[model samples]
Target chain A: MSNGYVFLSIAAMAVTTYLIRMLPMAIFRKKIENRWIKSFLYYVPYVVLSAMTFPAIFTSTGSVLGAASGCAVAIMLAYFDKGLLTVAIGAAAMAFIVQFAGM
Target chain B: MNLKEVKEGIKVGIPIALGYFAVSVAFGVSSVQSGVPFWGATLISLTNLTSAGQKAGVDVMAAGGSIFLIVLTTLIINMRYFLMGVSMSQKVEEKMPMWKRLLIAFGITDEIYAMSMSRSTHLTGSYMAGLIIPPIFGWTGGTLVGSVATGFMPSILAEAMGIALYGMFIAVIVPPSRRNGNVLLGVISAVILSVAFTYAPVLQIFSEWSVIIITVLVSAFMATFFPVKEGADNE
Candidate 1:
């Protein structure tokens, strides 16, 4: 793409991003008093993070074994109360090992 | 908005800025390495204030994804912020003008919102503005400097520093997970769902969007049904 096209693309993306971000607050100014709705919103981040992180663990090489091993490492680390860095590293390490071992 | 509140916002934001400095510098360096123009990456980092989304954007760009795919994927990743902004809107004084609300809302990162909401002090408009100062400067400053100095940092060093972002996430996930059983459930559920989606064959029809949808639905199902009682912050 040309420089102009790239700039336009970025601008378009930026606008979409900004409006998506700002619109909820603009539309829903009232405090969410509904219990179920509030509960749903509270879990939104956890859901978002999970969605983003899940596919990477098992699908790095289009294989299930590697992904499963990687996720097992991550879950173990998380269960043991290892910090984010540890979980990431543990999972990445397991994935790398699985890849190297050709298992 | 009084001068004092701005000052207080700056004071409160300083630590956040310091934290941003290290991580954002890593982000800047990586973006440049991934073939984005330094200015473009710097501007995105300055304006967006979202590290994971930016990283995902860079990865997509590196893989030569189309503009539509890139933006769509990023939008999907960042949808949680909409709810975050809603919660913040509820926290602020009702009559705050739209323009001011828009301006202040730019600073609603995970840390800043938490700190601002947790305070017992009734925040004036200036105080709220002040809260944004350090992080904005810290993030912008880090991106600007790191973009220019990108070539000097070794890749291994940059990779090591990238751990900071993960560390920040750990800090967030751990404390709360320990305090509440529901939070722990949410985290574990996320991990399990993530693994399942990655591995299962018949379910492979799910794209990134499906992963997001399923995770959100599953987590909301868990959290809503098993509601964790949270302590309210008195401001």
Candidate 2:
């Protein structure tokens, strides 16, 4: 891609993301009173994160076995309440091991 | 603007920054692999503090998609930030000025938002600035290193590291799901829906919009059936 294309795309993305994050914080001072709206907001992050992780994760490592091993280890570590670094490193390590073993 | 609060925020931000560094290194490498130049990838990280949104945007750009598509996909992928910003609007110190909020809002990532909201006291401009500063360096620095080093690193190690971001995502949601059934349901529903979108032939057409559609449907479903209890908004 040309420099201009990449630059323009980045600019557009940056502006779009900024507006989404900035609008509410800059404008809304009062508490959101609607139960459904509040609840939707509360759950949005988790659902988005979850949806993005799966299916995509399985293909991340180029090897299903390796990715699955890594994912399983990640889930196990995270379920035990491991910190983000620990869980992430653990998953990468597991994927490396599985890939190295060619299993 | 309190020094003490800024110091406290920096202290809390250390681990979060470290995590961002690891994940963003992977981001840098992958974006480069996807056809973005090293500097372009780093620039994206610098300009956009988000993880998933940046990834989605880069994917679109790498495919030669239009600027409009890039903005639209990023908007949908990042829609959750709107909600986070709303919650933050309520949580910020009562007297925080508009300019400070605007500047601080630029740095609101998922981790930053969660950390700020978890604080026992109302968020202060000084503390938020402190908390956000390190992660910016970590994210951008990691991208610089990763993108520049991609040519030298072995492919195996680079590919293995691909799982790091997902692992971090799992860390973010799994613990909460364990503590809250509503969260558990939301996650399960999202995973199932996402898989269906990926594998089901008929649903494959919507794969491009899967993240937005699935997020809205599942979040709304949970909100309607298992609305979070009042005053328990932190989760």
Give the clash count for each candidate.
5, 0
Q: How does model 1 fare in lDDT?
A: 0.64
Off by over 4 Å in 2: B1-5, B62-66, B90-93, B118-124
lDDT of 2 at A9: 93
lDDT of 2 by residue, B1-235 (tens): 6999999999988888887898899888878877899999999999998887888787678768778778888887787788788878888898888999899889888789889988999999889988999999999989889888878898888888878878888998899999988899999999999999999999988786777788889989999999989887563
DockQ for all candidate structures vs. native: 0.25, 0.71
**Best TM-score goes to which candidate?**
2
Residue A21's lDDT in candidate 1 = 64
Chain A TM-scores, candidates in order: 0.62, 0.87
TM-score of 1: 0.73
Candidate 1 lDDT for residue B3: 88
How well is each residue in A1-103 modelled by candidate 1, as lDDT tens digits?
Answer: 3455446556655665676668765776655455665566566555555555445424433246755676666666776777555565565456556655666
Lowest-sum lDDT 10-residue window in model 2 chain B: B226-235
| Per-residue C-alpha lDDT of model 2 across residues A1-103, encoded as one tens digit per residue | 8999989999999999999989988876556678998788788879988888988898888588999999999999999999988998899899989998887
